[model samples]
Target: MPPERDQSTNPTGRQKSCARCVKSKRRCDLTQPSCLRCTRQHFTCSYPSRPAFNAIPVAEDNSPMPDSSIDNVASPFDMSLIQGHRNTSVQSRQDTCLLDLDVNAGLESIGILHDLRNTSPMPENQQTIIRSIRVPQAGECRWELTPSSYARISYAIDRMKQAPATMVLENQTPWSHPLLYEDCMPRVLQEAHATCALYLARNETNSAFFARHVIDRVKELTSSPPPTAPLDILARAHALILYQAINAFSGDLQLNAHVCPTFPHLEESIYALYASLQSSETPPSPTLISLYPATTARQAWRAFILRESSQRTLLILCQFMILLHLLQGRSYCFDHACVTSKITTSAHLWNAGSTIEFASAWNEKRHFLVADLDFSEVLEGAGPEDIDVFGRMILVTILGRDDMLGWFAERGGVF
Candidate 1:
């Protein structure tokens, strides 16, 4: 057996490891300021000012990063910069890059990001639910996000940024427009976070694991009390649809084929997202509409946000589904397949502010020429400029997207 090396020779006792090593859960060979590992990788070697906080052994160092690079340090939104040296080993929520837009500002955001790199393997049937730092909601709303889930969430949010976040499809109800304006941002961010873990998963097993986590999260979201309002439905369905789309397009052929068939699960989830959204052909009750109006313009503005947020998400799901089928040269049509036939009924939708405006828009009984008709039927009657149903037709057009939306922008129209 080899003898252990002596540690007494001119030592700085314990060396502070950078957040990267701490996060990576690797041993830090204290090589003065910048460790050998950090130098090799070119990762920013940062030391916290205060004493060690995490269980990992850390050396004491209070020196701050040079002021010139301080602005470019790690943020929760973009951790690529690496967390610069701070007094506290772990950053406070204020300094965290996950700053709230509005909906989650005061509301507790449950669960920290799960590190996918360190996730343990789970069986095919059983899922691993690690930890969720959810808002201190009445205990009923606790959601368990598996470890490394944060990376998934971050991934989804990053992809969602490629397109505009606002735009209602041809739909019938404007009553929820107020909800669309404000609540949409956080909800979508959450959905993005929830699905990214599964969709962008590195392998078949991890992708399945994350997919289960997403389904579990959705189940928890819709459990017990059950969603009572259209806005709630919008939010919940948005997450479901995003998860479904991400799972379907996760781009892992092995996972999609051998491990899990995308068709069965995809159709199942599509039905799940479309579930209870349209219980009846009629619009929601007036009482439900008046139940949560804005108290101030800020409140009203927030409510309006729901329209674009939920609307855009739905549109993306629809368009992305078509885009995928187009890419694969598959013949499965969205309008003919599942619950997409409601787009015509939903086409009466508009950006109405007040409940009265919403009611007016709802009562207009406007018919999108393509509504109640399948893609083939609609395509026959549609003029080049006519807007078809809410999600399907417009998506087909964008399948040939040569930055068509941008071209619309050039023509002073919101595509």
Candidate 2:
């Protein structure tokens, strides 16, 4: 047969078509689903022979485009001639463009646009809109936020922008309503106080190191890019965990002395406390904000005892140990001493004196010089002189001291 007649070609014309028919500009059979030409071309084909209807006419004003552009095209009835030409040109261009354009080029443009959009900082207004959408608190990846929490978060970000301190999230007690502590972690207050104490004790380098490491970690958790504003909820929660870590370990004497040795005075005291302890003696109680003896006398006492000032460091260490123990709860009694070495001894912690006994010993040994105390003199002949004076004073005072309680009470005892 004459190459079987191309049955797909209608005898007179076509009423339906497929994409292949449209591209070839051939009249379609106007079939419901697949036109003959498309079926032959192995293409899934359909046509909307009747034009789609639009209920609302598109306004010509310069408003942003609405979701449905298909509905608003000028009706073919009013512009059939122009519509035909436009349709032919559009179909021709579509075929040529699809055939000639590099498929990879479109993909590359899309990738570039994706990267640009991803890297760009979100607009503040858009961020506000997105943040308003709540996320679930607990579950398989749902997000929810209360209105109050949202306000706090926004306010916190604003504060961070104004002053780039690390952002902290605090969960106040359920009973409390107004959430008094600005940053929920009490440890920030503790750290600040610790820093002040370090400066007062003149441990500049140690203070700087502590500030750098811990502060940097806080900044890392609270801000994404070092100097960025306060973080979102997730970041703030992470920062809170860091504060918790600090609070838990900041006061451990061994860790504090070894890790943050800024204040010679504080570090020395810490060392002395450790040195003086009998194997059985408990570590000092946890330090708190109101912990006391906030006076120049205490400061001077600390300087002398640390022996960064004057006197034999060991002797000063011995004196500091005895005095600090007396100031704390309970006391020690020296039944027998074991001199492990020329400089080291182990004493026992015990309780054996009334207020009267302590007072009597204090009265006899008490020597006050009106001159401004100079530690330089104490260190001149540090070892024997310092040890003897301090040891005798501790011995007699513990043995026959009644006034110790009064002295401690007057100064807000360490315990």
lDDT of each: 0.35, 0.27
TM-score of 1: 0.32
Scored against the true structure, residue 294 in model 2 reaches a CA lDDT of 36
- Which run of 10 residues does model 1 get worst, by summed lDDT? 99-108
Query: What TM-score do all the candidates reach, one by one?
Result: 0.32, 0.14
lDDT of 2: 0.27
Off by over 4 Å in 1: 1-237, 244-262, 272-322, 333-340, 344-349, 353-370, 373-415
lDDT string, candidate 1, 377-413, tens digits: 4333433333422332343232223343444455555
Instruction: Give the count of colliding residue pairs in each prediction.
Output: 37, 28
- Whose lDDT is greatest here? 1
Q: Where does candidate 2 have its weakest 10-residue lDDT segment?
A: 343-352
